[model samples]
Target: MAGAAIKKKIGLFFGSFNPVHVGHMIIANYMATQTDLDQVWLVVSPQNPLKPKNSLARDYDRLHLVRLAIGENPNLRASDIEFSLPKPSYTIDTLTYLKEKYPDHQFVLIMGGDNLASLHRWKNYELLLRDHEIFVYRRPGYDIPQHFEEHPQVHFFEAPLMHISASYIRQAIQEGHSVQYLVTEPVFQYLESSALYKS
Candidate 1:
């Protein structure tokens, strides 16, 4: 007789994570603890189709920062899956690959309300909604659309509002402002020592 199967529910949070900050950490923590997800994986994109490549930091550096911010969290993980995929990574492709690779686990897409507002603009977004479940976190200004709000596959979760953004942190670093509380200690130290985001 075969052994009983072990399956897990994982939330995939896809981002460039130019420099992982406290806001990102808080959201991931909330998702892992407050929701049904067994684990949350931060999928670091090598190149986001919606973002310009020049505006991003090195892929490995961004991945490292994500690792630092998620330190010692048993339920949180950092994945560089998109790094090995083709450039200008698309969410649909990543999701498909993840589903194929981990057939035993159920994969859910995690995104901000802001992203949800523009989700229709993404490549093969219809297929995404048709095949997978998505967890949308409310952003400060953006609200999920009426139709999507009622979608069976979409679940909205309320997280503590955070105005912090990676671009803001980078700008502060460039202007020589203290980022003491903005990022995790390890990430802060790495940014400072590596002189990252200082133009």
Candidate 2:
């Protein structure tokens, strides 16, 4: 009875949404409604260490795109916590800061199965496994690696697969091809109006 009263559960999804798209929303919505998490926050990273800087869109622009994409979803939110942090954003450090800032919230990391395959390369990934739970969504051609099961905190969700990528979106925009349905209409408008990722 002592533990039955706690209701705050948070899902933390970290990514550089160079441009927020429908695929990202599908996974986030799936995790929020289908899982134990009460809310899902899209933590828009200012930078990602594993990806090349040249390919990344402006941090604030990406954040605004995320906000536009998630509009009016009470359970979904856009966060710019990484914008104030150091470059080459590290998830472990962000997680640590988040935990301290919101002590009552139980946070779970939401990621794609693709990340599970390369999680070991992340900085302090071992600590990530130790300190937080993971909710993994599937990706094409990327199976959840065996070692993830070695950690008791990891959980897999057979999330709906949406074959979309920011890279693809960027390429489409640069080619003057329509990416109309790949992302939300608002997002598409923002990208077109702002002339983002068109290079």
Candidate 3:
């Protein structure tokens, strides 16, 4: 008898990745190296429904930054799947498209504890938890609630946490301050030459 095929596990780490900081790279690398996932796709979301759109950098610029940050790592990838999707891309819709587009791969939702806490507010939030593997990383001051226990598919990891935020980086750059180590060298150089975040 032939053994059943093992589906390739891909963790979808969705984010704005405003400048693709070192903190984002750290989490993505940790997840890919430590987890059962074969690859981790850093999905650069064009627009998040819950987040304010006014602050986001250009879609292609963010995507390019993510790609530059990832470089040639086989386990990590940059994705612009949401660019062609509708405005304010919904998680469920993106998952559905991926499922249909690539049937041989298993997709997992990579998120922070803060995102898990606000799951109730997402579009089709129940269906998202019901059908997909949700991998959550811990964040400072945000803890996953005990009341919502769905153990089997929802997994948690204590990946290294950093207090750095994209907003803080943006604010710093806007104020003519240095953001040298926050982002990768390529990203830093790119930011140095362009006025992407400067108001």
lDDT of 2 by residue, 59-88 (tens): 888888999999899999999988887888
Candidate 3 structure lDDT: 0.92
- Per-residue lDDT over 155-194 for candidate 3, one digit per residue giving the tens place of the 0 to 100 score: 9899997789999999999999999999998889889999
Stretches of model 2 off by over 4 angstroms after superposition: 1-7
Q: Pick the candidate with the highest TM-score.
A: 3
Clashes of 3: 0
Write down the lDDT of every candidate, Cα atoms only: 0.90, 0.88, 0.92
RMSD of 1: 1.6
What's the distance in Å from true for residue 142, model 2?
2.3
Write down the worst ten-residue block by lDDT for model 3: 143-152
For model 1, residues 1-199, the per-residue Cα lDDT tens digits are: 9996877999999988888888898899999999999999999888888888898998899999999898899999999999888777988898888888999998999999999999999999999999889999988778678999899999999887578888999899999998988999999988888878999
Stronger candidate by TM-score (1 vs 3)? 3
| TM-score of candidate 3 to 2 decimals | 0.96
Q: What's the TM-score of each model vs. the native?
A: 0.95, 0.93, 0.96
**Candidate 1 — which residues are off by over 4 angstroms?**
1-6
